[model samples]
Target: MRDNIILACQTCKHRNYTSTKNKKTLPQKLELKKYCPFCREHTLHKETK
Candidate 1:
């Protein structure tokens, strides 16, 4: 099933985005290059617990 998850900016350590994922299919944590307003640039966002 799809589960809600929070994405945090790696550069500034700020929570920036929210998304969903299929936990059963993809067990690994999510990671994406997203724009962070705090950092004012595109940064690596990782899923947080």
Candidate 2:
């Protein structure tokens, strides 16, 4: 099982990948600083709490 999951950037949906190695604290890095490779921008991802 994973700690959390979410779908961000409806425009470039499923354009990025998230693995078990990608981990971060809530309301901080994980929720605020998700760098979207497709969009080439840092978008706020809604972490499923």
Task: State each model's CA lDDT, in order.
Answer: 0.96, 0.51
What lDDT is obtained when candidate 2 is compared to the true structure?
A: 0.51
Error of 1 at 1 (Å): 1.2
Q: Candidate 2 residues 1-49, lDDT tens each?
A: 3454554654466435443314543334343457787788887554432
lDDT at position 26, candidate 1: 93
Q: Report the error of model 1 at residue 30, Å.
A: 0.5
RMSD values for the candidates in order, in angstroms, are 0.5, 5.4
Q: Please give the lDDT score at residue 1 for candidate 2.
A: 31
Pairs in clash, predicted candidate 1: none
lDDT, candidate 1, 1-49, per-residue tens = 8999999999999998999999999999999999999999999999997
Candidate 1 residue spans exceeding 4 A from truth: none
Model 1 alpha-carbon miss at residue 11, Å: 0.8
